[model samples]
Target: MTGMFPATSMPDRDWWEALWPDPSGLLLSLGVEPSMTALDLCCGDGYFTAPLAKIVSGRVYALDLDPEMIVAAKAEVKHLGVSVLKWIVADAGDVAELIPEKIDFALIANTFHGVPDQPALVKAVARTLKPRGLFALVNWHQLPREHTTVLGQPRGPRAEMRMSPEAVAAVVEAAGFRLLRVVDLPPYHYGAVFEHKG
Candidate 1:
């Protein structure tokens, strides 16, 4: 948790969503289908969870480590008219225990770089997924601290906390996930999709 963003400091949900790529379209591009069960790991404010619920026919688990974030996400999605999501307040590293059922897809957005033990987190995620389940991650592209902090630049974790795409892929591979593909998400981020080998 050295470089992680504090839950208390999170921006308004609408404001946060406006700052990044659309989660629904992004998930669709990553091969997320309407019939899949997905996990929105480290989900913050239901920004991605709401859209995921709309797209996935099966259940979507929106889990965050902070209890306040879980409450906020639940309130945020109440008006979506969709009841496909289950909110869980737990650490990202405890997915295996927190999520009892197998999942078809697991999504981690903008939070992987700050994970204290990337390999352990990936392993836990892998364990929660069914065989061949997809694990998609969106992270800040490695850049200089000054570059990310400039006025009008997209808000993200510090540059030192960012990890290169290759580094993230390597961790996923070491955790028993086969590399699928990496896609550029926009002016400031990249998405990597992997498949659970187990």
Candidate 2:
């Protein structure tokens, strides 16, 4: 079964912007290069997908389980006048079969901790990546939910559901990926970049 991550539903756009501030810069910091064939896995509302498309000149594939989210993402990218190479509405667990070509980078943000079969998901991602391909995860810091706030209110997944960088590395590395580095995204998030060892 496809497991929905806790708090996977996006916050209001205002709060999301307030938290991320600059989605494009965040992607760049995660080692997304212009020439890379990228996938925005679980691309809720295309907040990062549009910017990623702009960065890579529309050579990006975006997928989310929610068709409504995909529609919103299509509209978001349309509003921005940039295009994604493909928009897929399917479970994230089926990504290897969904994407048509090997990807240089894949990003799943704010949802990794809730995946029911993270190792399986990582292995599926490993199958879709090119050798030495990058997989980036953006997750909430493993802090008490009450301690991490946006707009003066607690936000993100429950405290017990959060995963530390080391924990993430252990799971991902076991599935044929090497942890590259952990980037502090500040105010309650961190970005972990991994390289697929094919």
Top candidate when judged by TM-score against the true structure = 2
Clashes of each: 0, 0
User: For residues 1-198, what per-residue lDDT tens digits would candidate 1 score against the true structure?
Assistant: 432333224555555555555777888988789889999898877777878888885389988877887777786667676654567877778788987699999999878876778888999998999999999998777877556532455467667678898899888999898988998877667889999999
| Candidate 2 local lDDT, 1-198, one digit each (tens) | 654565677777877888989999999999999999999999998999999999998999999988888999999999989998889988888999988899999999988887888988899899989999999999999899999988988999888999999999999999999999999997789999999989
Query: What shift in Å separates residue 58 of candidate 2 from its native position after superposition?
Result: 0.6
CA lDDT of 80 in candidate 1?
A: 77
Judged by lDDT against the true structure, how good is candidate 2?
0.91
Point out where model 2 deviates above 4 Å: none
Model 2 lDDT, residue 7, Cα: 66
lDDT (C-alpha) at residue 65 in model 1: 76
lDDT of 1 at 2: 30
